[model samples]
Structures are given as C-alpha cells and as structure tokens.
Target: MYQLYYSPRNASAAVHWLLHDLNVPYELIRVDRKQQQQKSAEYLKLNPSGRIPTLLIDDQPLSETAAILITLCERHPEQAKMPALVSPDRSKFWQWMMYLTNTLQNELMVYFYPHTTDSNGIEAIKQAQVVRLAEILTLIDRELSHHTYLVGDTLTACDFFLFLLGYWCLALPQPLTEYPNLTRFMRLMAKHPSITAVNDIEQFDLDCDIFTFID
Candidate 1:
C-alpha cells in the first residue's frame, strides 16, 4: 500500500484523489498544516521540502503532485488514467500537465502568497497576478469549449489535476462558476466516484457548489 502524507485541501489533494481514482490501496497521514506539522523535523526527514502529499512507493518518498500522478498512472496502466507511451495524445498530456503545474499552479501561489516576494506591495502584486490568472482561466475556458476532456475524449490525470486547481479557484474574484465551460467541467468532475469519495473524507462542500464572488 502507498503511504500519503496530506493536509485537508492542500496541493496534496490531486494526489489523494488520483490514488482513489486508480483504486489503489493507500494510507493517509494528515500533516496538520494548521499546527505547522509539515515543517516538523520528523516530517522533514521524509520530505526535505516539507510539503504534503508525499507518496511512499516501495518505502521511498516521492514529492510533487504531477510526478506522483504520473507515477501512479504508469504503475497502474490497466486503470488507463493516462495515455499509452506511444499514443498521439501523449504530448498533449504532458503539455496540459506542465501548464497546470508550472503555469496555472504557480500563478495561484503568487496570488495567494504575494507577500512571499513583494511584502511592500502585497496587494498590488496580487492585483496584477489576478489579471494573469483571469487570462489563464479564459484560455482554459475556451479550450474546454472545444474539447470534452482536457486532452482527449477520455478522462486522464490532467482532468483530475484541473479539478484540484479549480477547487482552489472557488475563492477567486471572478468565481469559477462564471466560466460556463469550466463550471460545466467542475460540476461533471465533482460527481465522479473518486472525487465524491475524497470530498466526503475532506469535508469539502463541492457538491453544494459553494462558490460566490464577493465584490
């Protein structure tokens, strides 16, 4: 069984959901972000970066959400959570995965933690980042209008990753629900057995569509 260290609604969420989607046996160890347990020396030993959702595969620690998702998919090819090694969609899979992680995910980090780099003008930084995020969202919304899935017609890890990021966007200025296609995507993904199971465990109110823009 894989061991996953996670905190509720953290970056670990995607990995947590994927583990269930893949129907793999796994153990969840809550890192208690509220109490700063992720930075604890004991936890740091397992993950030097002190991040959550570290998967213990063969008793080896693996970090990064995208890496974990790919590893799990590659390990359980029968589940078909990702593309075949030679499939044409393989490139598209990598493209969306990297865009989600390196581009969209990083933009969110800046929006949420602007003070990390611009303590003097945190709000200003966030205002600028929000514009960039909106552009990213619009691009994704347009893309979704044409493709049933993020990559090909079938469900893949990219969809799961997008769902995780969309969950974060629930608090954005322009609510995720405002994007018709993304809202459609999220609503559809929320009903998946794997997502539903994780929602119940995490106590997330995704089913109720708890998203509203506060002006």
Candidate 2:
C-alpha cells in the first residue's frame, strides 16, 4: 500500500486525483500546513523540502508532483494516465507537464508571496510578472481552444497539472473568465470521474472551497 502525505487544497490534490484515477490502494496521511506539521523532524526525514503530497511506497518516499505523476504512470502503465515514453506525442506531453510544474506554478508562488525574494523595483516588477502570467494563461487558452484536453482528446497528467493551476488561479480575485478556453477546459476537467473522486475525499471540501468556481 502507498502512504500519501497531503493537505487537502494544495498541490497534493494533483496526486490525490491521480491516485483516485489509478484506483490503486493507498493511505491518505493528512499533513496540516497551517500547523506547520510538514516542518516536523519526522516529516522532514521523508521530504527535506517539507512539502505536501509525499508518497511512501513500501517505505521508500517520493516527493514533487511531476516525479510523483510520472512514477504513478510508470508503475501502473495499465492505467494509461500518461503517454508512453516512446510515443510521438510524448515530448509535447512532458513539455506541458514541466511547464505547469515549473513555470506556471513558480510564477503563481511569486504572485502570492512577492516579499519572499527581493522585489527589486517592486511595482514595475510586479506588473511585469502579472503580464507574463497573463501571456501564459492566454497561451493555455489558445491550446484548449481546439482540443478538449491539454494533450488531445483524452485526460492525461498534463490536464491534471493545468487543472490544478487553474484551480489556484480561480481562487484569486482575478477571474479566469478572461480566458474563455481555460474556463471551458476547467469546466470539462471538473466532470472527470477521477476528479470527482478527489472531491469526495474527506479533506477536499474543507480545503478546496476555491474549486466551487466550477459550480
């Protein structure tokens, strides 16, 4: 059995959704971020970064959403939640995954915590960052304009990655309605059975009130 250390409304939702999609037996161990439980020595031993969504598989621990998603896809190829390495679409598949994990996610973190790093010319830098994020969102909107999912027609890890990003964006005062395709994509993603399972998890409701954007 796999043990997943997670907080309800965080990026952990990605892994939670993936596990539900796989229907793989697993244990959900709640890590309360507000309580700073992730910083505990015992938890630190599992993930030095003290982040949520740490997966313990037979005592071996794994961290990071991209790595976890890839591992799950590989471990259970029968699930077909991700594209095959040799598949021609694999490059684009992995590109979108990394883009979400690295670029989109990093930018959003900056938006939320502008003081963490030197803002330099504070006002100017914030404006530039917002512009960059808007451009990225526009690109995603264009991509989804023609296809139902990030990769093509089917639900893949890429979709989950973007879905979580959209979820975060939705919580902000800024509405994603500006990006019509993205809004539609999120609505479509909300209907996935796997996603529904994640919402049904005990902690999801309390933690992900932002997801109510779908309703």
Residue pairs in candidate 2 whose N, alpha carbon or C atoms collide under 3 angstroms? none
- How well does model 1 score by local distance difference test? 0.85
The model with the greatest lDDT is 1
Q: Which residue segments of model 1 deviate by more than 4 Å?
A: 116-120, 210-215
**Every model's TM-score:** 0.93, 0.88
> Which candidate should be chosen as best, given TM-score against the real structure?
1
lDDT of the candidates, in the order given: 0.85, 0.81
Error of 2 at 125 (Å): 5.1
Residues 14-63, candidate 1, lDDT per residue (tens digit)?
88888998887999988888899989999999999987779999899999
Model 2 scores what on Cα lDDT? 0.81
Least lDDT summed over 10 consecutive residues: which range in candidate 1? 206-215
Q: Pairing residues by index, what is the TM-score of model 1?
A: 0.93
